[model samples]
Structures are given as structure tokens and as C-alpha cells.
Target: MEETINLKELFQILRKRLLMILAVTFTAVLASAIVSFYFITPIYQSSTQILVNQKKADNSIVQYNEVQTNVQLVNTYSIIIKSPAILDQVKKQLNLDMSVQELTNKINVASEKDSQVFSVTVQDAKPELAKDIANTTAAVFKEEVAKIMSVDNVSILSIAEVAKEQSPIKPQPMLNIAIAFVVGLMVSVGLAFLLEYLDNTIKREQDIEKILELPVLGVVTKMEEKKAAAAAVTKVREQTIGS
Candidate 1:
């Protein structure tokens, strides 16, 4: 036979297991809060911006073609900034004990659409280190690009500086706790429905009729012990008085 539950049954099941659901959700949020605040390490990010434009003399007006060429060159420069030739030098300059691939993983390069300005962002455990890496990477890329491409178009628009009050970019405790709470609520509600579905004991006349597919002839009413005893005593008194 097919079985289905309506919205009322679903609400009843959830209500019956409301305590369990609340407990699980609370535990999950607490665990997430603890891990996010105490166990996970915070990572800091720093970014530097560079402008890609051809170097022109003071009296020369910039040409349209040159501007377009510089815009296209930004893409190539973004790739070269993460290359081993550039990052290796950055690592050496910073005296960092990290490989080229590891350093590259910590760095990100992005440019705006149809724009000549690009940004280099670096992430590290130490705020100072992150700032240093961003600035050094930009400097090294600028110097190397001039030698490799025979063009001095890259100019540092802004160098990364360590923030006075540094805040980590990762390990957002509130967000983690919110996600955990949602997951826990879903799991608990699903478990409640599964448990309800697995229960097969007859609890009412409707249950027996539904499962057995037969008409219920009658239902035996259960009397309270005090009421039954009082009725028996009254009947015995009547019989004694009649005798």
C-alpha cells in the first residue's frame, strides 16, 4: 500500500521531536563557533594596484593605439606576475622559505574589464608578510617585465601597507555558525521523519482500521480504577438492602 503524510502530520512529527532538533542545532552552532574562534587560524590579505600605460615624454600626446596595446598587455603581465621568474625573485627578496608553487597559491591577480589597471593580492598568516609580498611582487614584476618585454609600461599605482588595525579575511565565525545551524536543522528534521515512518505500532482505532483494511466493530473503553471501585461498592450496598 502507498503511504503519504499531509502537512498536519509533518507538523506533528516536527513538534514531537522539537527538543531533539533544538539540541542538535544548538550543538552544531556551538561546535562551529568554537572551531572558528579557537581552532582555525586566521589569514590576512593585502593588495597592490598597478597601472599599465606606455611611458611617454612630457610633450607627447598619448596615442589611441598605444592605449589599446597597453590594455591588451595587462593580461600578459598578469600571467607573468605569477610566473616562476617573477615569484621566485619575490620569494628570494622576502627571504621566505616557500616554493614557487606555494607562493603562487597565496597570490591572486585580477584586472577590471576593459581597463588598464590590475591588482595583485596576497594572503598570509602575518599581516606584515602579506603586505610585503604584495608590494614585492608588484616591484619584481615591474622590473622583470621591462627587461623581458623591452617595455616600461608597468607603474606601481599604490603599494600595499599593513593596516593599523588588522582584521583576518578568513574564519568568519558567525557565517560558519549560521551554516552549521541550517545543516543541523535539516538533518534533525529528516531523522524525525524517518523515525516516524519506521514506527508501525497501532495507536488509535484509525490506525488499526487503516493497517488491517477491515471495519472496526467496537472499541473497549477503559474505566478508571477509582470509578470502577465506587460503582462496585454501590451495587453491593443495593443488593444487601434488598436482601
Candidate 2:
């Protein structure tokens, strides 16, 4: 019985604030759509694959040792790929306006354990620029690897290709709209309860009767517009006649 009464109150509050909830939900969805589609800039990602292969040698033992050495160097090379030393050359070679530090931030390098392949990913507002950055960073790293590590173990496995239909990863419209809708709904519900709590106006007959501890005789319906106007006119005519 208590739970049912609380549920009824909840329903009443929702019913009373249905319009505000809908208004807030609609506004939030619209704002999310607008910002996601028109205002936010799209970011494009491009990735290049490089192979960290061991240098070929005549001796089997030397080859095995070299492979192990290359595998161990993978983690170090991953860091070097994103370092300012390599990225600075990439920037200079590409004639990019971004600083080495900024370029490093935009680039990501990763390699799997025991795998010979590593991936270099770069993200930018322009798709072509992203691709160019990825490819150039890989090329710069490959050329300078021997100088940095004194081992020709790094090789360009695959160049970064311009994606046929690159999609932006950021400003996901559906996700943003969904989150906004939920947040708006929550905020609307909170505001509705707050307003209902703050409202001290007696809106129900029961409330008035309860406060006064008296039974209501009958409900007086409000007069219709036409009837109200007719009554006013009649009263004015009677007053004029009396005067």
C-alpha cells in the first residue's frame, strides 16, 4: 500500500511536468545534433604498418640472436617513433607547420609482443594530411633507424594509404544524442520534483479540505467565457438602471 501510494505520487508528478520534460529532451537532442553535425570539426585517422624484422645473416646463431635483439628493441623503437628526434625530421621533410612536440602528440605507435609488425597512427582534421603524416613519419623513422639504433632492423612493411571512405572518429552524433537525451531526462525529472516540492499552492480540493478539517459541500466549476461576459453585461445594465 505504501509503495503504491508513492508510485501514484511519482506518476502525478510526471504527468504534471510532462511538457517540461518533453521540451528539455527535444532541445537537448537538437543541440547535440547541431553541434555534432555542423559545429564540431571531424578528425580523420591514418595508420602505417612497419616490420621490425631481424637483419638477415649467414650464421643461424647470429640470425637467432639478431631476431631476439630486434624483438627486444620493439618497445624502445615504438617510443623512438613518437620521439621529437624522428618527428622533427618528419615535420621538416613534410614542411609541416606543426612543432615536433605537437606532431608527437598527434602520432601513436604500437606493436604487439612477439610480432614483427608495428603500426603508426596519425590523426588530423584533414584526411589527406593524416595519411601524409602517417606515411612520412614511417619513412622518416625507417631512414633514420640505422642511425639511431645502428641496426637496419626497421623496415617499411606497408605505406599508409589514403582511405577510400575515411570516417571521422569524433563527435559521434548518435552517442552524443543518446547521452544528451538521458541527461536531459534526468535533469527534467529532478527539476519537476524540485518545483513540485517548492510549490505551496493548493491545487486539489482534498488539500483545502484537509487543511481546514472540513468536508467539501460541492465543487464550483469556473464560468465559461461567454457566460462570464453575459453576466458582467447584465450586472452593468442593472447598476445603470438603479443609478
For this target, which candidate reaches the highest TM-score against the unseen true structure?
A: 1
How many backbone clashes can be found in candidate 2?
0
Overall lDDT per candidate, in order of appearance: 0.92, 0.87
Model 2 segments more than 4 A misplaced:
58-69, 205-243
CA lDDT, candidate 1, residue 217: 98
Tens digits of per-residue lDDT, candidate 2, 1-243, equal 989988999999999999999999889989999999999999888898998886665764656666777778888889888888888888888899977888888888888888778899998999898999999888888888889778787788878777678788887899999999999899989999999989989988987896899999888888999999999999999999999
TM-score of 2: 0.81
Report the poorest 10 consecutive residues by lDDT, candidate 1.
Answer: 1-10
Which lDDT tens digits does candidate 1 get at residues 117-203? Answer: 999999999999999999999999999999999988889999999878989999888899999999999998988898889998888
TM-score of each: 0.87, 0.81
Clashing pairs in 1: none
Task: Sum up the clashes in candidate 1.
Answer: 0
Model 1 spans > 4 angstroms off: 1-5, 220-243
Model 2: colliding residue pairs: none
Q: What is the C-alpha RMSD of each candidate to the true structure, in Å?
A: 3.8, 4.0
